[model samples]
Target: MGKEFIEIFEKWADTYDSSLTKDIEYKEVFRGYDQILDSVANKAFGEVVEFGPGTGNLTVKLLELGLSVTGIEPSPAMRKLADEKLKGKAVVKDGDFLSFTVEKKPDVFVSTYAFHHLTDKEKAEAITLYSNLLSSSGKIVFADTMFRSEEEYEKAKAAASQSGFHNLAADLAREYYSTIPKLKGMLEENGFTATFTRLNEFVWIMEGIKLQ
Candidate 1:
C-alpha cells in the first residue's frame, strides 16, 4: 500500500461501508468476520489487536470477548465507524497497517476481510510484522473469504481480461492473495507453527501459534 492508494481510499472512506453492505447478501457475508471472532472466544486470547478493522465490525466483537483490543484503521471514515460502534470500548488508531508499532505487543492479533487489500509482498511482510509482535506463545488468526487457489486465481485473471469488470476483478485478483497452502508456508517460514486448515467452507481461518 502506498500513500497514493491511502489517499484514494480516504476519499471513498465515507461511503465504503455502504458499498460493502448495502445489500442483504453483503450484510450476511460481512458478518462472517464477527462469527469468526465468536468461534474463538473460548481460546483465551489475551490483549488483542485488529488491523484494518473497517467499520469496527470485528473490533466490537473482539472487545466483547473481554480481551482488551486495539484497532488500527487508516481511513478516517472507517475509524469513525469503528468509533461509533466501539464507543470507547477499544483503542482506535488512525494509521497504516504496515508500521503501526505499539509499545506493548499484544497476545493475539487478528484481522477479518481486510488482508486481501494488501499486495502479495505486503502480505508476506505483514506475516513477519505480526510474528514479531507476538508473545512466546502468542496466537494469530486471519479470517477472510478472499483466499483463493492458484488455479482459481488464474481463471479469475483470464475472466477479468475479457469481461467488462476489468478493474473490479483486478482488485479482487490481487487483493484475495493466495490459497491456504501458500499462506501456511509463509506463516511457517516466519516462525509460526502448524498451518492453514479449514475452519469451514465459506470461511478460512489460518492460524499461527508461536513456539515456546
Candidate 2:
C-alpha cells in the first residue's frame, strides 16, 4: 500500500495543490491547514520535521515563521516539487514517515492533512516514535481528521457525492474520516498531552506537548 500510494502521489505531485482548492470543501480545508500552521508553530530556530508534505504548502508557512524544516516525504516527485516550492528554504528528504529516522531530534514536529494516510497500528506507533524524536518540551501541531459522530460521517459522504468532486480522492477521504480518534489517543498514550480542536468540518486540528 505504501509503495502504491507513493506512486499515486508522485503522479499527483505537480497538480495536487491546484486540485486541492478546486472544490469549495477542499479549498476551505486548505485554508484551515494554513491558518493552523501560522497560529501554533513556535520553534522558530531549531529544525522541524514535517510528514508527507504533498507540495510544501505548510512547509512554506513554517519557513515564513522563521523556522528551518526537514520534510519527510515518500514520493520522489513530491520531493522535487517541494524542493522547487521551497527552494533555498526547506530541506526535503525522500522518506516515509512510519520508518523514517533522523539522528537529531527535532524541536517541533507537525503533519497536516497527512496523518490519515497511516494505518491504525502505524498511527499508534508513530506517536510513540514522534515523542522520542522530539526534544524535551517539543510541540506538535497535528491537523487532520477526527472521530465523526456516525451521523456526521454519513453526512460528509453524502455531501461529497453531491459535490461532483468524486475522482480526486474519494476512498482515501473516507478512510481519513475514521482515523482521527485513534491517532489522538495514540498521542496521549505516548505521554504527549494532546488537545484536539475542530477547525472546519471533518478536518480536525490538534496540539501535543511533550512533557519534561
Name the candidate that leads on TM-score. 2
Judging by lDDT against the true structure, name the best candidate: 2
Model 1, 30-112: lDDT tens per residue?
Answer: 55444576654444388887777777767766676678888878877778877888888888886655867565778987877
Q: Which segments of candidate 2 are over 4 A away from where they belong?
A: 31-33, 40-45, 162-164, 172-176
* C-alpha positional error of residue 24 in candidate 1 after TM-score superposition, expressed in Å: 7.5
Provide TM-scores for the models. Answer: 0.79, 0.85
- Model 2 agreement with the true structure over 1-212: per-residue lDDT tens digits: 14557767877787787776675646655665556666546433477888888788888878877777888898889888888888768787777767676667788878877776777777777778778888888877767755556566667667767877574248435454554555667778888887777777666777888888
RMSD of each: 3.4, 2.6
Question: Candidate 2, 125: how far from true, in Å?
Answer: 0.8
Poorest stretch of ten by lDDT in candidate 1: 23-32
- Position 148, candidate 1: lDDT: 52
Q: Which residue runs of candidate 1 sit more than 4 Å off their true CA positions?
A: 1-34, 40-44, 146-148, 156-170, 174-176, 197-203
